[model samples]
Target chain A: MEIIKTSNLKKSYMLGNVEVKALNGVDTSIEQGEFVAIMGPSGCGKSTFLNLTGMLDTPTSGEIYLEGKDVTNMNSNMRAEYRLKYMGFVFQFFNLFNELTVMENVMFPMMLNKRSNYKERAKELLNLVGLGDRLNHLPSELSGGQQQRVTIARSLANDPKILLADEPTGNLDTASSIEIIELFRKLNQEQGQTIVMVTHSPEIGGMTDRIIHFRDGTIEH
Target chain B: MSSVFFYARKDAKKNWKMFVFVIMAIAISTANIIIINGFMDGLTDGFLEKTMDTSSGHINIYPNEQDKYIEGLGIKEKKLDGLDGVVAYSPRITAGGTLHYKEKFKTIKILALDPSKENEVTILLSKIDSGKTLAANDRDGILISYRLADDLKVKIGDEATIVFENGKIRVFKIRGILHTGLAMDTNTIIINFEDASEQLNLFNKASIILVKLQDGTLSGQYKNKISGELGIQKIKEWEQEIESVLSSFKTFRDISNFMNAIGLFTGAVSVGIVLYINILHRRRQIGILKAIGMKDSQVLFVYILQAVFLGIIGILIGDALGYAGTKYLEAHPFPDPTLGSLGPRFHLSLIYDASLVTMLIIILAAAIPALMASRTNIIKAIWGE
Candidate 1:
């Protein structure tokens, strides 16, 4: 079943007098349990597409359907609610709250949603990401790989249907990148988790169930 | 809800410098307000007490045709009947007089008081340092204030010649010395009304009638009744009688009050600016919150709660410091040149009522910035260049 879909999506930005079309006429869809990788060079609208699909950006002109519900023109508050319940994002920079402990960071989404059993669920997610021992430590005290693992734990806190990762291993070393890619494969294969990841590494891109290439906004499947 | 509070607490902890600045601003402003109000309250209370104790008997009576000082203005003794709230009435005759005590001469105000009635009007005579109260027939006996006695170099039982209106003179023995701790005391001498009536040749008439009202009764009604009975067109209330003194006190009080208000306003502004900057700096965090599905109202509430917390701390600090400062002032009073005339010391009561008002102001001031910070655009905050 298709869990994420976008139709004729276009995004433009005005840099002084010049209009830069970040995403132009892009149509794509990913299935419920698919581990998909979207590969592109720098400034090739890959991040823009991921942001739009993750509900972080509203396309200038397009339609987005999360689990068959059109969410193109939802208000900011409604969009936030939709994102909380159905979507999770992992930024290239990990983006863990620096002030919060690893356990607290993982529990952030559930806390915002007023979820019961936040502690148990956060503990479960931290253990799943192999950071159970580091739960009490702040993000600043953790290694880059450890922080990325915590970010992944936080993304799973809300039990989101589709995890959208924009360059999840972009800031990590070879071993951390392979470990993160293996985690994504495990989440998809063993747990039936659906993921849409954007990455530049061809080696990482080949490990996904399907690869979607982009040169200038539109996908080359 | 709890999440917002948790985050707000985290944020405040992370930014202790800003928090300290806000607290300090609020404390200083609150202290300024409290001290100024304390002084005003003390001065007004002191002035009013002294004036009531020394001169005006809380109420006064005079003829309807006589408004200002007149030669022969007195309420008839029979007119004292049918007055509901009258505690006592003292017939008084006031006239300028020149005194001679062994050639150390000085012009002074002479109050010809009915000795028995005068005791009911002023508490000063009862507090005499030496000698006894003059009898009704003691035409040769007089009471003088301690400061006046010192200036004239007169001792108890010493005779001083007093020259009244129309160059009429009478020699009276100073039987007592009164220290009322009021300006009027030093320049005033008290004599029996009988002697004054005989000397001034106004057998039954007096210059003024002092009426003491029953405690807790409204003097306004008594004043009207006295005016009606005496057919006096203008009877001055105690507040009006000391208008000059009251106005001066009021002016000083208002200036201090204005300064205190400004301090409070500035304290609020400081808190606001600090919180505003804090919000600006933490825009990314707010965006993260919004992205995590926190409602706009929720975000706004968190910041407001933080501001309220800061305001409370400020007000508490201010109240403590203000109270301590006022207490110190009370213990160590200012060297007042008017002390001899007014009193030895002036003290202020640190009122909780004013502090409550100041707390409300500081809280409101802090809350405004917090609310504004919360209501900012989350998307712009998150994704802006």
Candidate 2:
């Protein structure tokens, strides 16, 4: 049931003739329907690994298999198609489009994927996130936690098999953080969603079914 | 396509300030181009009409002149007797003369024409303002311009003495006043060729032959046939007679075109800056779009769609404003002393070709910025340093 797997992944960056290895020789796998948390200190390649796994960036040298289909060398347009059809992401900063209303923000991913029933699906997702009454409110009017909930709703719009969360609670208060975690738990336990989240908080990391801790560029456990 | 349209509408609504600014810039530039072109068209048409009315017939026939003094009196006359498309043929004697009325005298050019056939050569005589047209039996009657009558203190039926080159004197009565809306009217006089022949002492001679062809006939073929029959080396057409005037019009058109190009360039710059700022401000939105699996082309389409929206607004406004301005100018005309005694009136009619060219220029101005906006890179546009 290995839904996502990477073998000997390596990533590097060039800064003024000096090379920086962000992720070096990492191998990992996550089973289907598992809520997994990746834990690491700052600059420990957690975001890099998430980006690679989410298909936002390609590893320098590695093999990435999603549902047993190798996606390591996909072109830009092909990768975009794959991302639209099979994956969704929640960012650390709650990167909601300010110009769009809360409902419109949630509807963005579906619109991008050209879903025919985008409006109805968006309303349903907003209701599920408990923000149906605030559909017309813009992102700027929403609090950090509300915005994160809207982002979560948007991630589900395409019915993606794999949902990637990069510090989803990074910018929320304690109460908002707990509410968001409970929502994730509901989505994972009830709806059997497969989620891979990156977090610095041990408390949030502990709530996941499995935790992968990392230091520098290597997994510690 | 529907999704892109929806997003574009939202984006334009969100950035209404930039949108309005771009539209206004386009509109103003387009309006300027239209108004200038219209004005030029009006002026050129007015000049051409006056020239045709006062001087040259639609077609003129003259002897080929290899030398400067291909004497006007030496013109040969042939019987165009049974030509199917020939309308009217009038022979004329042209010479510069001086008229003396009271104590004042002024030099003028006289066209000694057959009184019965003169209307075929110059149509403006039919629009005479005072007295009667010259009759075939009237040997000593002359038709003088209204402005010349005013300058000479002469009225209809008053006698004016004209002095020909050989010191021959002929005292002629002013039979009528010709008022053409043109400058040449003030310096022209019409007299019967018999009296002109008696005064100048040139018998059975004419300076030029004018032929008014039937409407819709091929003037070129007729002109060539006439040239071949007459064995003349040079045959001048209506267009050739006004070569200098047409050249001036072409020069003005080129200047207007250059001005329109500059205006469009500036408009494009304004739109470009507006779009650049818009893209910079919406960088995060673009990033979010890309993260949501939107391709670069899709993101670029949104910006291009926005630019097109702005261009359409601009062109519409510009065309309206230009049309209104031109109409206003047409309705209110300034006095032109060159239009003789008929008084000045608004010149409105423009050449259709010029108007079409101006419209094309305006459209091109609006489209360049939109196309440029469509080529912007989504990732770089979004991820600014």
Tell how far residue B159 is off in model 1, in angstroms.
8.6
* lDDT tens readout by residue for model 1, B122-210: 66567566778667678789888777888998999899999896699879899888766567667788888888878878766777778
Error of 2 at B301 (Å): 1.7
Docking class of 1: acceptable
Pairs in steric clash, model 1: B63-B232, B64-B231, B64-B232, B64-B233, B182-B341
Q: Model 2, range A47-132, lDDT digits (tens) per residue?
A: 88988888877889988999888999998788878888899888877888887898888787787788888999999989988899
lDDT accuracy of residue B153 in candidate 2: 83
Docking tier of model 2: it is: acceptable
Candidate 2's displacement at residue A213, Å, is: 3.2
lDDT, candidate 2, B1-385, per-residue tens = 6667778789899889867877887777777777777766667777777777656765676655653222343334444545667777777777888898989887877878886676765675675888988888888788888788888888899899898767888899999997776665777888888888778877766677677778624777877876776666666677777776778779877987788778776777777777777766767667667667877667667767776777777777877777777777667765665543221222333223323443454445435443444444433444343
Model 2 interface DockQ: 0.48
